[model samples]
Target: MRRIITTIDIGTTAISTIVAERQKDGGIRILGVAQGPTFGMRRGSVVDIDEVTVSLKKTIQEASKASGMNIKKAVVGVGGTHINTYNTKGVVAISRADGEIAEEDVRRVIQAAENSIPKNPNREIIHIIPREYKIDNESGIKDPVGMTGIRLEVDAMIVDGSKSALRSIIKCVEGAGVEIDDFIFSSLASAEAVLSRRQKELGVMLLDIGGGTSNYSVWEEGRLVQAGVFPVGGTHITHDIAVGLQVHIDTAEKIKLEYGHAIPELFSKKDVIKLADFGLNGDDVYLKRHIAEIVEARFKDIFELASKELKRIDRFGLLPAGVVLIGGASHIPGIEEIAKKELRLPIEVGKKVNLPQPTDKNLQELLFTYPVALGLVAWQVNQLSGDNRYFYNPTFESVSSKIKNWFKVFIP
Candidate 1:
């Protein structure tokens, strides 16, 4: 029997599920995928338990029908402005009698790091990533296992979220009769889909623009360096267009997708969009420039915030791989150009690469918007089987293993 893995991406605008089989060749064969309008989630946090539960059931059922398999567990993606990271350090005395480091000693040191998390009744640690290790006062050690040292120290990054918000998501998933195998940050999952090894090594920023929010992750030297979420997203642009054009939300969204351009200069004055059918019975016909102006304004603001974040991290000058844009909002016309201009960095639209060429029109349409969901599936399989042939590792895997072993004792 083929081992199956499922991943759910609960976003501000939609909830998606993907079930795939782990093939012997280390590639994932997508068995089924399902999506529904999201509820109970805003800017990546669960807000309504009942609504989230109902949405999860709908998507899971759809995926089950297509895959012909029952999914009992899943890897879920989480994001929101409520999510934050802190830098922490920990030290421990080595217990090895001969003063030689062993696996158990390494495990203990990592546990010490995790145990040092400050107690916050409102927040819970979601992930702990060790940035570096020190052996016996000697710093810059990446892997301390098997190294002789009397003391062990570690620098780590702790990702935490509002406990109530996280519990709500977990309760909804469990209420749907499935366990969560793991939870990854939303931007980290998106980074798995679009970033190449070279980009991570040279430093890269990934921005996933969903319906209600935009999520970001920065990678450098083959490790996740930072992650954050912005409360604004593609939905804001639609709202702007709606208000600017004096049209309904649905009509505004349709116009934004069909005629929206982030750069006005790229569009010609001769270009026109028909608004008569849209019930805009006005003497002034809708011009492409108007739509571009509305989209550009919102998009510029989003990119400006992203730039400010980079500046705060002192990473503004270091992203040689520039910015990679993905998710539902990335489909807007001229987005790549707008991002390049506003962020002053090289920009590219993230496209799904590892799929069979669609032989039908319907499949092609589905492929375009579901890259994040598909990428989530890819990440799930990779984590379960330990195969990441596509990317390079800048950090020692031993560190991840040590952290995972320690976490299992508490989180499971």
Candidate 2:
């Protein structure tokens, strides 16, 4: 039987679905992709299950029809203000007659780290990525499966989300008649799609600016150090434009996309455009520079908020790989230059590069707004190739087996 994977990205602005097949030579072939306007979501969290389910069903049906495959299971991306992340460490004695670390021992240590998370009724752990391992007195070890050690320890990053929010997302997907393979953090998924291995190793930050939220993640020494979601996003810029120019939201959105720039200095003050060009039904003309000022203000706020997060983690302006911007808002003219100036770091707009072959030109355009969805499928492919027991197949044989596999993380 041929192996196929599908992924759904439920974002604030749109729902994206992609289906791909794993080739015999370990390459991925894009079979189909679809996207539609998302509803009942704000800042990446589902507010209405019925509306989200309807949108999801349509998205999945479109992709399935295009790919000529039934969409039964998929990995989903989740993000929003409800998401929380932090670091923790766990230690345990190797349980063996000869003091040798084994695969079970690794699992135990990770379990120990998981146990350290505070049990809160409102919160649930979604991801536990092992950052590094220490065996006996040795530290900074990536793998110690066959090594002899009396003491085994691990440091990991645990991603948690609001229990109610998670349940809402799960219920919506299940209602759409699709079973979820797993839930991945939205920013982490975007990072998987756009970031190079070398950038992660050299310390980098990824900012995915969507419609209602800007999700971010920092990586250092080949491991995720921090991840978060900010409520401000491209929609805020549009709102600012609407209020400043006294135009409808739809008209403001069109203007922002057609003429917006993140740095006001790059635009000419003398260049005036009529509001009627954007169907605003007004005779007044506005200078491009004034419009850019509004965009620059919002962009500044987003970058400064991200800078505060880096400061809190003591990694501000320290990352050699600097900042990589992705998602819908990343297309704003001069956004990268503004981000570099605001954060005092190197900046680049991120693009998808890990796909082995993508035949559809439309797929390339969707990749910008659908990185999280594409990353979800890419993540599953990596897991299967690496022989991940938890996600080896789409369905589990029993409840016990499912429980055992459910909590596994992407860290190796």
Candidate 3:
């Protein structure tokens, strides 16, 4: 029996792994968590399989040892610039003679929704999540099972990616001695970790800022309205800092973590950083405000891009619950203030909490880094037990087998 859930997020900047157990209660107990730098991936897609395999093996071994659990199979989180999403609707005549909708009817409508999208040889369906459903004159039904309806209709968000890219990720994970159990969109997994039902219902945006690209999702009325990835991320910021300061990438990353701020005015002109302080040269110094300016410009562009994406979906700055920032880039100081100024909405950092008793010190500190992993754990727990209460929306079926069922729907 599989009682524990293991998750690995293949990110652009880092590979995050976590081993957690679902308690008798609804909460999760973090047994072990670990992260490793991405040696072979860029923008969340595999580039060098060998390097990624070695790095993933090390991270998995570390987490397994910490938890004293033998890790065999793992749920994988996927995100990249290759990811693309669009919305389409499908309708089907209810098959039951009594006109009472059943689970099979719901499934058929979802499959119809997917079939409406033409197949692309170069791309594959990564996720086909049902967003809304309609029955004849009735609309907005979430779960239509047991409901009376004549014509069943569904609107779904289709997420697809480069087929070659996905195959490479599967190969790398398997090469590391762990079998891939399932695949979930990394941003959606992060939503499971940080978003509450009320937040989704009241309208909220989730921004998962990673290393090479940032993944964002908009939720309103308890359904996903939009999902997109920005090509710029923390790595771009570090690159800008390195170029502006004429320093090494490592040095720029260190400075960004130490003194990075989205609001340059928050720092005084007199507050200076000496090169020697960070194991660099002697006596040379740079004004903190100047460094802040470099960091601020890059993030401003990210938020501005986010504003445009929101406007495309007509949810621009209108989410009542506002935007929740997660992932590695969210650690930057004063980032929320910059987001607020650029987007004209309330900005907040996603909460890292609600873990079971005996919380590991590492989990408490690095929970921010493992949002997607935590979400994978939550998702698996719900899948095994059919616990739809975890998330208000009912889209878990598509997390793994939804695509397979798409073709099965055509069979007589």
Candidate 4:
């Protein structure tokens, strides 16, 4: 029997679902992918349950039809302004008479580190990434299994999200008749699909700019160190375009795609683009430089916010691999140039090279936009049988459920 796996990403602008089959050779093949306009979601969080549920049902149903699979369970992607991350450390003593550290000892140390964080009723831990381990004061141990040490220590990064926001996501998915196998942060998932081993080890930052929110993840020394979400994204840019050009949002989005560039100086004032089709004057001509100016402003703001997060962790100039950009907004022209200028760092756009290309060429390009969905499948496969290279702690144990069924809402 073919092992069927599905991943669902409910974003502010769209609901994307990817259904894949695990091949006999331990590879994944794309079976179906559905990308539909999202409704009732704002800044990556569900706002209207009924509307979001309807969109989710439609997206999953389309994928189900294409793949001919029921897709009862899925690994979901969640991110928004409510997401947060911080560094934490956990320590524990080996519970064996021989002082040998076993797998359980490693889990205990990670659990201890997770427990170090203050409990917040409103927040729920989403990811616990072990940075490094120390055994018997010998520091910098990456793996502690099968080692002899009386004392074990682990430094990890804890990713958390709003409890209310998480519950809302769960409700939407369950309403769609899909069980949630696990929930991964959108930026982390994107990093899995785009970031390289060298980038993670040498230090790199990833930004996944969706329609309503921009999510970021920083990896250094082969570990995720920081992650966050900004309330601003492509949708905000479209709104700005609409307000500035006196056009409808749909038209502004089209113009932004067709004419917008992040670095205004690269374009000429004399070079004008006609927007007569968008209800502009009969001789409607807009200075390309002016459109670029608006694009540059918001993009600068995004980089500035990202800079603040890097500054907080003292990683502004510390990352040698620099910044990697992904998501829908990253497609905007001249964004890399503007990011390089504004952030004063090397910049490159992230691509979905890690995944196997779909048989349909058009669907292969969809991987770039729907990377989180792909990463969700990758993470699940890895968790089930593949070596646990990424963060694999199943659920946060310290924070008690604020609402009944909150933690178990998606479980079958």
* All-Cα superposition RMSD per candidate: 5.5, 4.7, 4.0, 3.1
TM-score of each: 0.85, 0.91, 0.92, 0.92
Per-residue lDDT for 208-304 in model 3, tens only? 8889999998898988888878887899999998999888899999998888888788788789998898987678788899998998999998998
lDDT of 1: 0.76
Candidate 3 residue spans exceeding 4 A from truth: 354-366, 388-412
lDDT of 4: 0.82
Query: Candidates' lDDT values, in order?
Result: 0.76, 0.82, 0.81, 0.82
Candidate 3 weakest lDDT stretch, 10 residues: 389-398
In angstroms, give how far residue 160 of model 3 lies from its true place. 1.2
Backbone steric clashes in candidate 1, count: 0
Please count the clashing residue pairs in each candidate, in the order shown. Answer: 0, 0, 0, 1
Q: How close is candidate 2 to the true structure, as a TM-score?
A: 0.91
Per-residue lDDT tens digits for candidate 1, residues 96-123, read 7888888677567666776776677566
- Model 2, residue 127: C-alpha shift (Å): 0.4
Q: What pairs collide in candidate 3? A: none
* Cα TM-score of candidate 1: 0.85
Q: Compared with the true structure, what per-residue lDDT tens digits does model 2 show for residues 39-59?
A: 999888999999999999999
